[model samples]
Target chain A: MIENFKKRFQKDGIWVLFLLPALLIYLVFMAAPLLDSMRLSLYTGKGYTPTEFVGLQNYIDLFTNPVWRERFLGALKNTVIFFAIHMIVQNSLGLFFANLLSQDFKGRNFFRTIIFAPATLSVLVTGFLWTLILNPHWGAINQTLKAIGLDSWAKPWLGDENLALVTISLASVWQWVGMPTVLFLAGLLGISDEILEAARVDGASSWHIFWKIKFPLLKPVVGVVAILTFVDNFNAFDVIYAMAGAKGEPGYSTDLLATFFYRTGIAGEHPIGIPNMGMGAAIATITFVILMTGVLIWLYSSRKNEDLV
Target chain B: MSRTQKLFTYSALSIWAFVAIFPIWTLIVNSFKPQKEIFSNPFGLPQNFTLEGYKAVWLKGNFGTYFLNTIYVTVISLALIIFFGSLAAYALAKWNSKSSTALYVFFIAGLMIPIRLGTIDLVRLMQFLNLQDTIWSLIPVYVAMGMPISIFILTAFVKNLPREMFDAAKVDGASEWRIYLQIVVPLLRPAIATVAIFNMMKIWNDFWFPLVFIRAEESRTVALGVSLLFGQYRTDWTRALSTLSLAAIPILILYILLSREFIKGLTAGAVKG
Candidate 1:
């Protein structure tokens, strides 16, 4: 039996070697941390120093406790607002640009390149750039507004609780609209020109053709972009963290879920020095579940559509 | 094709083109103006066009070093992704059975799952491996993170490769390894280029990885270095604008020169779903 086992190991050794690196990396890094975070979420304490087996108490507090509950719901509302703004501004603008550029024009390539340029820059860079532009006191935007006799419109966009989230979301939209535009453009190109010509022959208006024909054909690609937007918007951290800092603050106005988790986990309670890894982990777990549900629903819908077809 | 509709389309395209190009133009023009002019008349051309900002940015910031570091990381990562990624993809594609399908799914699962979820443990693992605060730490992570998407694209391309080439190679007593290197690799050039461009832009522009992993200023990539510069001084518009223009110019020139291929690659990658 020993000899047979040794021979089997020797024969399979190369495959084992080939698989070792990826498996080791994934297991050590991906799987273990996720599991650990989930495990951490079950334990609770005053802070980082856990002393009790709370067993979903953190989650319970999240839902039941007013202080935590309000914060949670507020962040959720802001996130929804953020996402709604992006869908309207980013996706709609992307569709508009895609529609415009679908028809040939001089320097079309150059236009595409410039339009997509912001997407290539890091969001951190883009965020900082816009923050400077929108700075209330010394911003070029205000200066331009004043120069053009529109000075009344200028405000501390990032410093106002009311405008901070909206302003930041618009900046995010500007940086990312290129992505969906290109995706939509690709979808447009995939559509047969002959069908569009047929619509033309039928005396359909351009807007009518776009709404009735191309829009329906582009549903799958649109679905993909939507899910992508969903995942990315939820995972968003760097831009907000860089621009608004961890609290999403102008008095916690922009406090996103990711930032909230970060503050609780690592930065600690400002008044308190202790970190609450367990609670943070619980929040992270909830966030992950929400994201996973979104993804799974998307996959199921796509698969069901395929089955029907 | 109605005249009025055509006119509207052209007008819309023109307006968008203006909007897109305007910010870039503003950055460039702003970089050439002195700080006072920039603040006083934000919209006009520079009163006295100067290279002083560029001179200052290059001399003081050591942007050259940042540029070199970015290029090194991006190029090396690209080579690895194209090579190992393609090799693994070819195996997954050619095996064409239940086990390979499982492996394919295993690799592609990394797509839906964000790598940041594993970030805590990854940092610890990097520390344990003693790769913290180093460029080497980024390479493997980037490669591993990038593999699934690269494989997905390359596999699609591989599936479309002409079968006769493989058949001919097989008839000449070529092994699978030989067929992959000799026959398959060359035909994959366009797809590989497409993949390379997409990955290059991601690496060159990434800030999160650098912010988390690279602690030393000496180790900073262009994106991180420039951001650090911005952070140090809150209201230095002249220098900040200089830095922004510096970061953008190289990529701008690249995009302008290869606009067609670059846009093609982007649209192709995105719409593939």
Candidate 2:
């Protein structure tokens, strides 16, 4: 029995050492805190430490309480819009660029490099850069419009409540379009050349080929791209914080779930100027649930069909 | 193939290319001009060049220290993630067991979820460990955050590796560690490069974690520092542009130098192959 146990230990020991470091760090640093934050959401705290367990009270306030409810719903709505624009504009442009690049082309590498350049820069930098370019009175866009004698076209880009979210979302789309471009390009390249050639031999145009054949094959990648956009925009913060400020300024037209959480939980929310840790955790939990639901759906759907990705 | 198709592709691509390059061009060229000139000539090349913005950024801020801090965190976190991540991935690829399969699924789940959700408890965790407000705090968090994707990519790469290589090494009486180092490590260089570049972009350019975890001048990262300076220098366009250019230029230069590898690396996570 002792010898058998030793043999089993010998077989296990090396793998255990290999796995433990990453696993322990992942659990203690990332996974545990994520789970604990959910638990902490149930209890209100005047400080860092929660004094009382108010089970589900924080969530209730988040849903029903006037102030929290408005911010939560506003952020949720804006995130959806932000994600929609990314899906429609960024991914579409990405597919467009990918289609163009996948064809026999000159300077394809150069264009691909230029297209993806913005994504490498910090979102804070891009956010601030766009804030400068989109400045109302003296920005590049306005100045160009004025110079071109289309002065009427230039308006408050970031200042308007109606247009601010779209403007920021476009800026974000501009920055990250390269990602989906690269992804789609890979998917496009993966299409067996013979199949596309056969379609062309049958007199199919590029448009029909792209929509009818290429797109259906690219579904798995699209799902990946969609879930990526969802996770990113749902928690989108740095862009808004940098462009619009942490309060999601211009009357909070640009507040995202992440920035909203920052204001409420980490920094004190405005006016009352006190950190509500529990409420912030509640927001985080909600965001987590939304993300998990989106992910599970994608997973279930993808599992049903053999993915090209 | 047709004239019209080629023309449409070139023109459309050229136009989109311009849209892509224009803002960044404005950013870089504007930084070199003086304050008044920035507003006057936002579109033109710097007619009269000035290093005033760069000088002010250097003198007025801990920009140098923040730059170094970012590098330190990125390198340390990357080293940990690669070392530990590769080890686990190697075992997962080689070991045929139900537990390994289960563990692999567990790590891969992190790819879909954002790590920011844990900031509430993470803040407390940092404070509890006396790591809050220190650059030391960022490393562990980043390594942990990097794990899932690193494991996801590396394990796939490793699993695709030839079985004969591992068997041959073992047949020659090599230990698992020996096989990993001598055989696996060399073969994994490309995948390692992919994982490194991916995580480097995240760690180097991240603003959120630095904002939450580190506040001291000594501890601030390039992203956090730039954001702070942007807030302070809102009205001073020249300085703001220069500060941004400073933070952005290194990675931009890196991207330019290694565009092919960089593009491939960034897409590694999404593209299964």
Candidate 3:
């Protein structure tokens, strides 16, 4: 066994040289910190230092303690609502657009470029731009509504508590719908011309063909898109932070786990904000677990589906 | 398709396209308008195109410095990600051992787990390394964050290369390193471009790491700079819009020029994986 191992090492050892730099960097920066953060979550701390191991007390507080629980549950509900909006509004529009663009329309590339343009821009730019457009005073939406004789329709979209979360979700959907559209378009294109042609030869209408043939084939892509959206929405922060500030203002209506984690762990409370690194780490660990579990379940189920197929 | 269906498609596409471009249009138009004009006619074209907003942001806000800093960070990080990622991908693709499979899985796992969750300890780690608040601090983290997808994409590309070439090189007495440097590196150009473009977008537009890791003014990237400017100039609509336009316009122009490559790189990984 030793001789066999030595022979294998001698043959493949050069590969280690190639892998070492990235491995070292990823292990140190990405992997190590993840473990350390999980460890930190088990301890209690006042500032940046974790002094005592109160194993899982932080997690307990995250669920039971009123303040932390309120914020956590609120952020979790908002996050789910955020994901639901994407799954419904953003993805449906993406599919509709993908279906439209899939037709051999003139200037398809032009339209594709225009639609996907926002996805490439910085989230900060998108958030800032939308904040101006949605601003209650002298903002374009309100002014346009007034101009068109719907004077009472426009409100402070980002400033109203009830409307804030939905408004931010809509703005984010506006920026990112193109991603799923492009992905679905790719999936649409993957259907062979022969199959489409055969379906056309039949009396099946385009709608029937899409529903009966194309949509079924696109299930895998749909699953992938759903999982991607789930992970991304759960991890979302930049757009909300850019628009509503870190507090997820308008009464924390737009607070996400990401922003809440930022507030608790990194930034702490404003003006005499003592950093609750332990609690923050707890939040981060919870987020990590939820995300991993979601992805693993999707992976396992998708693999099972493939086997059954 | 029927005439009505065609018309519907056209109208829907047109409306959505308009919606997509409207915010950006507002930014550009309002950035040039005087403040009072923007307030009065939010949707109208600027009465007169003015460079004052741009000038103020460029000179007073020091966006020029932030722009250069962003470019520096983005380029350096992309270089490191592509170099190390391609090397590691090449090894994993060619070695074809049990350990290679394990390593591939390990790296790809980074994709599902958002690295930002580890921000708490990452900050502590950076402080321990004495690298906090420096521009150089971002490079390693970005490289590490970007490696998983880079390695994943490049490995697929490497595996597609003809095997006889490597076998022939081995027979010619060329060392593995020389072969990789001379033969494999050159052949991986398309994959490198794909990886570079993807990483460039992420590292260029990333705000989270730069926000947490760097607080010093000298190290602020464009995203952080623009966000900070927006906060400071909340009521200065013209200047705020101008700063956003400055941050956005270059990327929009690049996207237009390279939309095909950008879309291809983005969709390629999704379709395959």
- Runs with alpha carbons beyond 4 Å of true place in candidate 1: A1-36, A43-58, A64-70, A266-280, B50-62
lDDT of candidate 3 vs native? 0.90
In candidate 3, chain A reaches a TM of 0.97
Please report how far candidate 2 places residue A288 from its true position, in Å.
0.5
DockQ of each: 0.40, 0.87, 0.86
Q: Clashes in each model (backbone N, CA, C under 3 Å)?
A: 3, 0, 0
Number of the top-ranking candidate, with DockQ as the measure: 2
* Per-candidate TM-score, chain A: 0.91, 0.96, 0.97
Q: Which DockQ-derived CAPRI band holds candidate 1?
A: acceptable
Poorest 10 consecutive residues of model 2 chain A by lDDT? A300-309
- DockQ-based ranking, best first? 2, 3, 1
- C-alpha-based local distance difference test score of model 2: 0.90
State each model's TM-score restricted to chain B: 0.95, 0.98, 0.97
* Tens-place lDDT digits, model 2, residues A1-309: 999989976997788788999999999988999999899998887768776899999988888999779988999888888889998999999999999999987888888888898999899999999999999988989888999999898999999999899999999999999999999998899999999999999999999999999999899899888888888888899999988999887898999888889988998866777778888899999999999999999888888877545
